[model samples]
Structures are given as structure tokens and as C-alpha cells.
Target: MKNKNVFNYLKQLHADNAEYKEQMAELKKLPHEYQVVYKEIQNFLWEFTSGDGMDMLQPMYGLLDFFKEGAGNQVPVLDLVGEDVGEFAETMLHEIQAKTRINELKRKMNERVKKEINQNK
Candidate 1:
């Protein structure tokens, strides 16, 4: 059972990793300025990774999406994130952290409900 669990975990990880790579490839194709700023924001957010650090990924993807939209519109990178990029990163971090907390609460609630249903059966 343990081996099965580990295999499943690894399988899911390998599958999901491809998507991350794709996002990175898209980032690479972006304008040099956007690439530089995205990497900077990515590094800044990484410093605050919680536990397994998976939560940081969502914000990064969001940032990439944001950059992609801006690039599509031909907006300057500075205009996209403002002159203070650090401030922009902090705002994203705050939003993701808040979202993480809310997700945890929802997960706990669902687990409790699941437990109750299991017990009733």
C-alpha cells in the first residue's frame, strides 16, 4: 500500500511537472524585460513559501498570466507592475496567502463533513 501511494504520488508529480515547464517556456518567449521582472517576482515570493511550498506556484502562474496579457497588449513591463515591482509582488503574496488560508478552512470543513458521512454509513 505504501509503495502504491508513493507510485501514485510520483506519477502525479511527473504529470504536473510538465505544465510547470510549459509555463516556464511561455515565460521564456516573453519579452526580455518581462522575463527579468517575472524572475525577480518569483524569487521574492519564493522566500515566503509555506510548508511544502506548493502555494507559491499559484501566484507565479497568476503572475505569468498577467505578464502574458500585458505583453499581448504591448504594455511596458513597468506599466504592468508599476515602478515598484517589489510592492506588486508583496500584493500578490498577500492575496495568495489569504487564499491559502481560506482553502485550508474549506478543506477542513469538507473533511469534517466527509468524516460525518463515513461514520453515519
Candidate 2:
């Protein structure tokens, strides 16, 4: 007789791995800053993975609004299962914008400091 338990376990493992690979591929397609944001959101989602679906709803809706602001309004929230994966995508978009703004401020501040030092020299 076939060992159905081991066979099922192996099959399930393969399916899980495939899903992970697909998600990785999607992340790789994003710009570098957005990829960093996606990973951060992934970490945030990790904690809620074992929690109830209700717990994720608030965060998911917050994420959906982030997407809606950025042209991802078309992303279907209902079609997503478990914790909404849209959170990862949308958070990345918003985070990347924030990072860009911060970087610009840093550059301007650095330029001012350099100008001050050059004047003192």
C-alpha cells in the first residue's frame, strides 16, 4: 500500500514552495526602494500570520487605502485570501515615496553643511 501521509506531506511542501517562489518573483519586479519596503511589510505581516483574520482586516484596509492613493485602486481586495498580499504591494509604493523625500532632504542638508565648511576654510 502507498504511504499516503508522506506523499501528501511532500506534495503540500512543493505547493508551498511554489507559492513562495511566485511571491519572490513579484517582489523582484519592483524598484529597489520599493523592494525594501515590500520586505519590511512582509515582516510586519509575518507576526499576524498566526492570528485571526479579523485582526488583519484593519491593517489590510489601511494598506488598501495606501494603494488607492497610488493608482492601485483597481487591486481587488476580496480576491485576496488570508492576510491581504496587497499590503505588501501598496506599502512598498508609499514607503518608496517617503524614502525619496527623506533622501532629498538629506542631500539638501548635506549641501548646506558642505557650503558652511567651505566658507570657514
Best candidate, lDDT: 1
Question: Candidate 1 vs. truth: CA RMSD?
Answer: 7.0
Q: Residue 49 CA error for candidate 1 (Å)?
A: 0.2
Stretch of 10 with least lDDT, candidate 1: 97-106
| Candidate 1 residue-wise lDDT at 31 | 97
1-121: candidate 1 lDDT, tens digit per residue:
9999999999978877887899999999999999999999988877776455567776788889999999999999999899999999888877776445446667889999999999999
lDDT of every predicted structure (CA atoms)? 0.85, 0.51
C-alpha lDDT (0 to 100) for residue 43 of candidate 1: 85
Steric overlap count per candidate: 0, 0
Cα-based TM-score, every candidate: 0.76, 0.39
Full-model lDDT, candidate 1: 0.85
Clashing pairs in 1: none
